[model samples]
Target: MQLPGDPRIDAIAEALLADPGDDRDLEAWAGELRISERTITRAFRSSTGLSFAHWRQALRIHRGLAMLAEGLEVHAVSDQLGYGHPSTFIAAFRRVMGTTPGAYADQP
Candidate 1:
């Protein structure tokens, strides 16, 4: 998806794209940007067509695909993306990609 035009939203998007494993919540970002958390939440949904938390999960899972393709083990990718447990990462991956990380990596 293209970056949203709002400079503040764009800044958040760029940061996440650069570091998808950031794991920072919208409240933290809003605090850093000196905006109300509600403003950030509304702007994020309006600009991206996705709530901030959902977008961040999608972004992390998308990045996980690349890592898996590059031969990273599921546990390794999960750890690198800041998942506290491989099972959590696997569940999120399955939701986004319709397959477990190991299954995805085995695709020809």
Candidate 2:
């Protein structure tokens, strides 16, 4: 949460939250931030205790959960979140939330 200590990390996090479907990888972020990928990697790990991939996936999972709660269909949420396949989204969701999207959505 506060590990990176670099404003660029914050900017990247904000951008991801705003648009999780952006599938740009670490290199793209490094390029945009005008820093080496290794630098970004170290800063990100120091700040969040998670790699950029994991953190970004977490963000997408949270957003997907929210969208599902709002009555969006599973497939739609998957596509909107840039998952190439519904199963991919489901797998990630299960990994993070310990339940399938449909099951979570069914909870009152």
- The top-ranked prediction according to TM-score is 1
For candidate 2, write residues 1-108 as lDDT tens digits: 222456758878877777889888888888988988888777678888888889888889988978998899999999999899999999999999999999998888
lDDT for 45 in candidate 2 is 82
Whole-model lDDT values for every prediction:
0.85, 0.85
Per-residue alpha-carbon lDDT of candidate 1 for residues 52-89, written as tens digits (9 for 90 to 100): 88888888898898888888888999988878999999
Q: List residue ranges in candidate 2 displaced over 4 A.
A: 1-5
Worst 10 residues of 1 by lDDT: 1-10
